[model samples]
Target: MRPQDSPTRETKRLDGRWHFLADPAGAGRAERWFATPLQARDGVEEMPVPASYNDLTTRPDLRDHIGEVWYQREVRIPRGWAGERILLRLESATHRATVWVGETELGSHEGGYLPFDVDLTDHARAGELVRVSVAVDNRLTWQSIPPGVVEDTDAGPRQRYWHDFFNYAGLHRSVWLHSLPQTRIEDITVLPDLDGDTGLVDYAVEHSGQGSVSVQVLDASGAVVASDDGAAGVIRIAGVHPWEVGEGYQYTLRVTLSSDGEVADVYDQRFGVRTVAIEGAQILLNGEPVYLTGFGMHEDHVARGKGYDDASWKLDFELLDWIGANSLRTSHYPYAEDVMDYADAHGILVIDEAPAVGLNMAIGGGIFGGQGYTTFSPDTANEATRANHAQVLTELYQRDKNRPSVIVWSIANEPESDTDASYDYFAPLFAHMRSLDSRRPVGYVNVMLSPYGKDKLAGLCDLYMLNRYYGWYVDSGDLDNAMLHLRDELGQWAQDGKPILMTEYGADTLAGLHSLDGATWSEEYQQDLLEATHAVFDEVEEFVGEHIWNFADFQTTKGIMRVDGNKKGVFTRDRRPKAAAHRVRERWTRIRGRA
Candidate 1:
């Protein structure tokens, strides 16, 4: 029974338990891990799906360790899904994987945090079982890992990053076996008409073998307000509604694919009809001047680590809500889809990015291990590497394009930008993203405040975001001094005539676990900094809104003069609130007149 509606439509996931395997690096080489007839036989170690692997590891370390994680699971098709087309999907696999249906090949997918799905109507025997195998890439991004402790090397050389935070591997998000139709809504391009307040919905079809498609638009009450014949790319919804953050109005854009009037596929996505543009040096949300207030987040917590479960996501969202955050930066990379969905539903704007953090920028101020960053200039390179980077962007767009919460698509985090030659290589990569979704903006956090690359491609991005650690890194810095440095940095972008975003800023503190007496780790020190930061933040409304250095204390292998990853989260690594957290929350409350 193929889907009478849309077959390729993806389902929204809430919760489920997933089985995972704990093995060493390269344990699953060439499908050998789960190749055995009995091995693909399902029901291994049942770790919770949609959970991180770090929580289950015995090492309980943040960095400098060797281990591999192999994940396998049994998927039960819901009885209700018996008659429809079903499939198995993963929001991300840490490294690589080969999926199988009882020894028969379905497909293989790689790249962490990228979503991929496989057809199951034919391979799956209605109520039968299926197995998913994955081999992750924890070793390569070891240095790139946030911060943690490791005591073994049954694996390879430990990879470490100079920055702060831990990198937990495994199926850190969710695993799902969904039901779909033969032909369904594969993708959509909502080119809302802003000129006359009309809506244009352009959608694509996913069919098995070959078939025709029918599309329609339904209002909140389930009436066919607009309909189109054939597979026309555009359908107009007259009298469109607008969506703004505080206003909270939304619509469900539905596309139905049909074969000879029999429904083949159906896709329903919730989106707000709105436009985001740059007015000089500012971001206009829904045609209104807006400010971005939030914190940077890494996917690590104290004891639980990457194995953090769905409950952890709830905790994170609760904490964010309490802190008055309207936005979140998936620091250095993209995060679990559900996390972004929560933001979308809850009204938190997102900056979805690729996992292209470059360590070529004078690593730890020591050997500059990862300084050249993305292009692999004199570093990691091969045609495969460049292709991998491009794949990441494509995967990101495909997985999250329907999300109204995602406002921007960043190509690389902070690539070294002090030279023209670097920009020459970086330019084409930036252009590639524009090619995919010309609807959103693309950007990167700058290496440092420099005139060399200020707004070099203003058309490429709507806002110029700068990531700086000035007061903490360069000056002993009073807030005023930091302001001067910030102003100096902004001068170039101002000349370039681009809106600015103070993208990353804030001093790290251990939240509730602060050590008094030692001013370096004291709560007072962090509070004073936040106080100063807010004071200056209020004054710099003309630049761009600010998101603090971090939302929670995360892992980092760049254990420099301190412990793993900077312990600067407003809350402790375990989600405990710090003194500074309260201060910042209170300040925001005051700003909103809710204190």
Candidate 2:
């Protein structure tokens, strides 16, 4: 559902301090913790909402705790919100969560990194004290989307997964208590296209009750350029301004629903007039070939793990502008809605992805590993996992379908795409995505192990996204051989006649380490690696983009390979620029100027 507030809607943000408790033994539910106010209970501590509870304190037990955690807060509904439909909206609840309002269960959601709403109109009264409690589980299993397994160790229960990122869990986004009209507009779908010098906008609205729908296309100056009177129709505008790369031109589609000749609800959807298409070996935006130059980003920070911070996000965009980059991939999962909105307003392109990582068992030594088992076996990533993956794809499409910056939909990142069983598993998912929305192209990130010769799913993709660690994982510290191997691989992929984008290629370098001989893990080596990769990218005719492995340093599970966290970022964890950042700025600025 559309959660954006409008003229007829009111929302109150429930972000701040809340009483927190860790249920390591999983006794919260059996003890009936949600039956009363949590403040009345003993051994309760205060923690900040909209942030991960992992690194918020000094206790190691709390930092590395598994199982369930509880958050409770008291909110007083506004007296003016009487006669309105009140709803409790959780922007995100990591992994899984269940909600309660004074012993009465509201609802439960299974996925993380997406918004879900629980009806509160009949459960609580307006202008009254309402207690809200949430129980979130950080456990993952074979049935989970990004599948994982829990091992019973001598110390305690251990969570293991194949993904490189850390498992930062809790409420990592904002929560809201919003009010809407009883018979209000539920959803809006806007499709904008360019025709010669005219703009055509096709729209469809879904409402709860019967009403007459009226739509108006307004330009940037708030002038009505086109109008239509129906729930689903097309509005055409003459002398329209097409939304081009690096030019944030948008038109507002104002939708109003009327019942008995009176206005019931109004929603203003901001959209741009543009279209995405792929020619022979070129990715087109508005019928013009466009080059993508950016990095694969993560929703991570210094203390706030995967939490949304406005200041840090703004700084990231400023740095992107300084580097002269145009696009980025929401690596491994879909990012926050605020990030998508900023990309829309600032003219930065995005490749929206699903949380379908770590589907391979060979890397993580999963339960079926060393047993001659495939990744798509009945005991592993089988039908249940695929079903969950499809559900996330549906939710992702529903949430970001209207954003103009989202040009491509990436199904998964570095899945096991080489085996025939893997192909059988993902083929239907790719088709399912197309059935959901046929306007955008869909693809998956190919790992180095699944090269052009062995990958079976490459024939099914609209474009090829390759993540090769040539100089880092493959030919370590050998730039000459690395470039040769990279060129050979690109030549093999060019035979498919599809546009290729290097989604991830980088070396981990310490922030302060420098070497005159270009040794691995040194700042100079990172810069040299990038330069060498860029040289290969320019020589390939089918290459359309070059996105670095990571934008900044981020936290990960502790291992001998990582010092504190992954040091593959061009910038430090605190947004400090490294030597590679300067090299990238110079190279990308020249490329942008040439384009």
Q: Whose TM-score is greatest here?
A: 2
Candidate 2 lDDT over 1-595, as tens digits, reads 6565787788899999999999988999999999977777777899888888899888988878888999999999988889999999988788889999888899998788788899899988889999999999888888787778787899878887777888888998889999988878988899988899998888999998988899999899999999999899888989999887777788999989998898888889899889999999999999999889999988889888888888989999999989888999998788888888899887889999998888876555212233233578898888988998999999999999999999999999888988889999999999999998898889999988888889999988999999998998889999999999999999999998999999999999999999989999999999999999999999999999999988999888877777788889999889899999998999898888843
Per-residue lDDT, model 2, residue 131, is: 93
> In model 2, what are the clashing residue pairs, if there are any?
none
Q: What is the alpha-carbon lDDT of model 1 when measured against the actual structure?
A: 0.62
How many residue pairs clash in all the candidates, one count each?
56, 0
The digit string of per-residue lDDT tens for model 1 on 254-322 reads: 665666767666666666666776677677766676677787787775654654356888999888778
> All models: lDDT?
0.62, 0.89
Best by lDDT: 2
- Score candidate 2 by TM-score against the native: 0.97
- The candidate 1 region of ten consecutive residues with least summed lDDT is 142-151
